[model samples]
Target: MLFFLLLTIIICVLVMFYIKWVKVRSYWAERGVPFDPPNPFLGSLTFLMRKNPSLWMRDIYERHRSRYVGVWLFWRPALVVNTPELARNILVRDSGNFRNKFMTASTSDPIGSLNLLLTKDPAWTGIRKRVSLAFTSSKLKSVQAVAAAKSLDLVTRIHEEGVAEISLRTMFSDYTTDVFSAASLELDSNTTLTGEGAVRDITKEIMEFSLPRGLAWCAIFFWPDMAELFRVNFLPKKSTDFLRRILRAKFKAKSVELNKDPKTVLEILMQMMRKSQDQEKAYSEDCIMAQAAALLVGGYETTSSALTYITYLLAHSPRQQEKLYQELLVAEEKHGHHNMEGVIADCQYIDCVIKEALRMFPPMAWLDRVALHDYKVDDSLTIEAGTPVYVNGVGMQVDPEFYPDPYTFDPERFTAESIPYTYMPFGDGPRICIGKRYAMITLKNAIAAIILNFEVLPCPNSPKPAEAEIQKKGLFLMPGEDLKVKFISRK
Candidate 1:
């Protein structure tokens, strides 16, 4: 009799869960919204079982070209904005109601949580204001010099690699790592030349896309409560601990002299820390470390991957490559090769190439935000508080309706007319990427330096544009395969 009673209770609980899940799944449909039926377990992401989530999201975006489309993030209803008009309303018009990003893993990892990327309104605003004061035009120019120096270093190192087929992704990764290290930490991490360092190793480990890490990130973004239940951490403990140790050691070695005019990002943060004693200004030491780590993570992989893609595009489109080479030559002769900062600023074609590459392959693929309170998107659609909303950035950029023959490698399109909210490589509105200026300078300097020093030729085994090996699941949407290329010296 006891055994039967226990079985009956277990069955009852299972039935109750099933009923709740069904109701949650149908929430969007009941609101007169078009939606794909979510999976019983993984919700709409069950398709990830067979295909890449980025591609899967793109597919959904293609299927629904109207105002918005509904999808479930593991039974959590999410609205993906398809049109620029609606996107503008969400991103800029009603920015206040959508200030917080849809990711939450702070409880699991305190240091990782303090960064501006994850923090909510008042805290984010305060940090942003204080941090923005560091990235002045003049200060960014100083960082630009560091990028130029690193670019030259990169060119010198690549040439030394000789006639060997080199992985462009790995090579660019080293260059970007060196640049970010010099800019943010004020340390010379010559990863490009030496090919090893604590900074490089730790950043690589933090950025590496693994199965467990990917799942944890997804849990944090899609279902924070579930992520909290399972104790999901934003970054690996090993990587975070290493960064903390490095920062702590630096702090212990010398008393930071508060500079009136700070040059490096680390110095700027230290200055802020000195003045952040007021309870209102919460620029804690952990917050400083988190921002530095965030900058490294943000700059490392995205710039490298972007440079690799542009290199590949140039290799396949030799006409455009030659045109860019000629442009670089003119700029070099006019400004001198050493004047890479000036050279990049003048190269209009280079700007177009980078913009086009970003449009085709956005770093994050989607910009996720949570409705802070009950918000009305349009006359027809109004979502409740805590609903997840995503901008299908990849979808918007690649849509044939926006750009004719969207798959073609044409920088000319960018040079022609500008789309308002469509070309968001660094995102849109007040919450746009803080490191965008630094990233652009680094990309331009690196690409110009490489093109001036060597001709980027396609390897025999180079994958076709459509056949590139993109990761099935990862935090960032980027190529997974080795991009082998031949570097024929211009000298």
Candidate 2:
């Protein structure tokens, strides 16, 4: 009698699960939407651990070729926006309905949860407004010296390390780390020269990926509930603690002279916090440190990865590389070698090459947002509040309809007027990357220095740019293998 009762309970539970699965599997089909048949357990996210999300998104775009595609993140239904018009609407035109990002972190991880990348409004608004002050034209101009110096250091490092022996990502990361540390934190980090420093160590940790770290990021991004339940942290605690210690030291030293003009990015943020305190709407130390950490992570990783891709892409496309070199030569002759102003204002081909590379390999390839209320996606469907939406930035960037021969590394495509909202490597709207100008300045300076000093060539036995391995574990669109290129001295 006992065995029969146990068997009956098991059978009933299985029936309930089967009924639930049927409804879940038919969600998009019921809504008259285009979708791939979801796996019984993983839904549309079977690609999570097996494939890079960016490549997966591109594949989905190619497969459906629809304005929107229905997908499920595990059992939860979500939408992926493919068209530029809808991307523009959700990201900018009607952004109020999608203010917060779908990605989130646990409250236990304040450093992760409070950063500009994950924080929700009205805190997001406050933090963004204050942080905007640090990236203004005049402020970026102040860091020109730092970028110029680091570019020269990069050239020296290449000469010393021998380009064939160097890992493009690591070499560029060192350069970017030095530039950001010196310009933002007022720290004289010599990682670009020695490949080691306290800050550099921190950045290296942040860049290092493992199974656990990958899972944590996956949870934070695709399964926020799991992130909260399991207490996943976006940043390692040791790194954050070290940053806090250094930050406190700097703040104490700076506080001693309150009237001094703010110089570094940290100083600007410190000033903002001081004013907030004066107004009795004080920002906490954790909040300030979170922004500092965000800038550090954003500053080094995105720019370095972009620099890596740009260099590798140029290595394979000699004709385009020559075009860029000529452009840089003209700018150098016109404004001298160290004038970043000339590179920023006059180097058109260089700009085009950078844009093309970013189009092919955007570090943060997807824009994630959640609906605050019932939202009409189109005349055909209305998604309820709390539904997650992903604007596939890379998907549209690679769409052949938008960009002819999207796989080819042609810089000329950008010389023509691009379709509106079709290319947003830095993202779109009010929450777009605040460091875009700073990043451009850094890229322009470094690329000019390298091109003017050395000619990059494709190393033998290496994979082509398009065939390069993408990181399967990382959340960002980064290289999975070492990308090496031969550099011959132009001097």
Q: At residue 11, what lDDT does model 2 achieve?
A: 100
The RMSD of every model to the true structure, in order and in angstroms, is 1.8, 1.8
Give candidate 2's whole-model lDDT: 0.88
Local distance difference test, each candidate: 0.81, 0.88
Candidate 1, residues 77-138: lDDT per residue as tens digits? 88998888877877898888888889877465666577777877787898888777657888
Off by over 4 Å in 2: 1-8, 256-263, 275-281
lDDT of 1 at 386: 93
Q: In model 1, what is the error at residue 433, expressed in angstroms?
A: 0.3
What clash pairs does model 1 have?
39-43
TM-score of 1: 0.96
Model 2 clashes, total count: 0
Model 1, residue 423: distance off in Å is: 1.0
Query: Could you estimate the TM-score for every candidate?
Result: 0.96, 0.96
